[model samples]
Target: MKRLIAWISDLRLAIGLLILIAIASGLGTLVPQQESAELYHRVYDAQPWLGLLNGNAILRLQLDHVYSSSWFLGLLAWLGLSLILCSWRRQWPALQAALRWIDYSSPRQLSKLNLAETLSCSDASQELQRLEDLLSQRGWQVQPHPDRLAARRGASGRVGPLLVHAGLVVLMVGAAWGALAGQRLERFLAPGNELELVNRRGETQLTVALEGFGIERDPAGRPEQFRSQLRLQPGDPNAAVPLPASTETISVNHPLRFQGMTVYQADWALAAIQVQLGQSPILELPLQSFPQLGDQVWGIVLPTRPDGSNPVLLALSSEQGPVTAYSAEAEILGTLVPGGGPAEIAGIPLRIAGVVPASGLLLKRDPGVPLVYAGFAIALAGGALSLIATRQLWAIAEPKQHKLHVAGLCNRNLAAFSRELPALLTELQQG
Candidate 1:
């Protein structure tokens, strides 16, 4: 049991676990996560890089959602346990030892330190007082005795390793918590459409309203930006008194944050277009993708006569532009711009009233984000603390012999401390 605990708490084991977790995270980034099994088969079945990883293999290995996978969570759990154990077994005790002042009975023990200096001086009492004052000014905590004095500085450095371990554990816990309980939602909402925020259990929590959405296109007709104007209401639909709605606009990199949830403008799509045909009621035609025709082309089939006699295909590549009509034989019949007057196609007049655009918003709620940020802050502070060099100085004033013995030791920056010690001795001798 002792051996096992030691091995688990070993620094090497922690480093190995970190490396494994990093590799797993990299793999998670490379693979599209939480997608359907069919998508995995369609994407990787014929790909040379991951061709051998079929749908079954992906599912069996939990590669579809690596962060939430049992193996990855197990690694996190193991690493957290290791950090806790190491902190408990090593860092805590070391910190306690550093905080406690150990009194040396003789100068011999002090002289044996890795960095040590001995000094001889007259007027032992005055020199000892001056040394104590100098050490105090240098932030050393002094412990005085009748025969000797012990002083140490930068003892907080010992606490740094403990905090570092604690921060790592907190970080791992946050990541695990996020992977286990966080929620994500992707939706395409048209203007004036309202959607309720639902949990994994399908329970509505809040309400989201899409006020408007727009896409900015470049000179070459490529999309440059997608923006969504949204409103967030606090409560579910069943609330007795509905909360005030807050409005926000989100663009590509800018996201709206509210009630611990973030709404990102991920994409945009042409939902449908309202068109009037020959004095009939406005027909809302839902657009379908025609990638073979053009990458951004969307179209719908409509009958020319009121009796649904002659079918014609109407296609458009952009929301702002000319919608082309095609005959059953695939020949171009006519072209009509959006909001343009009715144009005759196959002897029936057609008018495009308006285009409906949908905003694709990705909503995410991660409860562990605060914890992760806090852990990073703590880790940075601990790393800064660890850089402080803990230096110690000891002195004995033997008044009867009319001499003072002094020695210094430092855990870091030994050469600088060595030079400072000699200068301090010279000051004591001259004074």
Candidate 2:
């Protein structure tokens, strides 16, 4: 058990685990995740990298969902365990040692230090007292004994490592908790539509209304960003509403955080086309993607006759204007704008009412988000505090020899500590 504990708490083992976790995270970034099996097979199997890595290997390794993979989560868990053990076995004892004072008795003991010196003194006791007062003035914790004195500065550096370990462990636990119980849902909604938010009991607890959506475009007619206008209301509108409904707009990178859930505008799509034929009522025709023509090109088919004999395709690259009409032979007949002049299609006047756009909203709920934030704050604070150099000083006075022996060392920045030691001896001599 002792050996196992030692092995788990080994510093090298912890470092190795960190390196492995970093490499795995890098790989996860390089690989696309949560894609369909068909997409993976069609892409990876068509052109296998290195002639060995195919879709089969990717699926076998569970790289499609790297973060949720058993091996990846296991690595995080192992690293968290290592941090806990290291703090318990190594960092705690180191902190305790830093808090204690070590008295130097003889010249031999002072000579063993990296920085040691001897100074002539008339009254050793008076010099020791003055030195202790000087150290206290310099913000060092000074403890004077009958024959010796010790001073410590920046001892808080010792606690930094323990705080860092605790923060990391909390972070890992929070991540694991989020992964186990969090929820992510993506839904496309058009204006006047609503998405139902369900609870664990399969009851509708809330309703997210798609009030409106708009796409902001540059002067060149290219989309710069898209926003979704939404409202949150009670699932049953007739019930006495506890939460007030308010309209909000959310765009890419600017999400709406409300009631423990976050809503983001993720994507946009052309849902349908509204048209009117002569004296008939306005009709909405569903649009389909045309990847062969170009990206973001959507088209709809409408039959000229009542029996749906000959179909004419109306394709549009964007929602603004200029919808191109294509005949049965896939030849462009004419181009027209929505809500503009009527177009003659097979001798029947046709007018385009408008194009309907749908907004893709992504909602996420993570209970451990606050815990993760706290962990990050603690980790960053600890990392900054650890940079403080911990310095220790020891001195012993010999009235018979009329010499004061001083020694000091620093956990970091030893050269600066060495220079300070000489300056300290000079001050004692002057005193």
What TM-score would each prediction reach against the true structure? 0.86, 0.91
Give the Cα lDDT of each candidate: 0.85, 0.86
Q: What's the C-alpha lDDT at position 332 in model 1?
A: 96
Model 2 global lDDT (CA atoms, 0 to 1)? 0.86
Prediction RMSDs, each to the true structure: 3.3, 2.6
lDDT of 2 at 329: 94
Worst lDDT 10-window in candidate 1: 114-123
Q: How close is candidate 1 to the true structure, as a TM-score?
A: 0.86
User: Model 1 lDDT vs. the true structure?
Assistant: 0.85
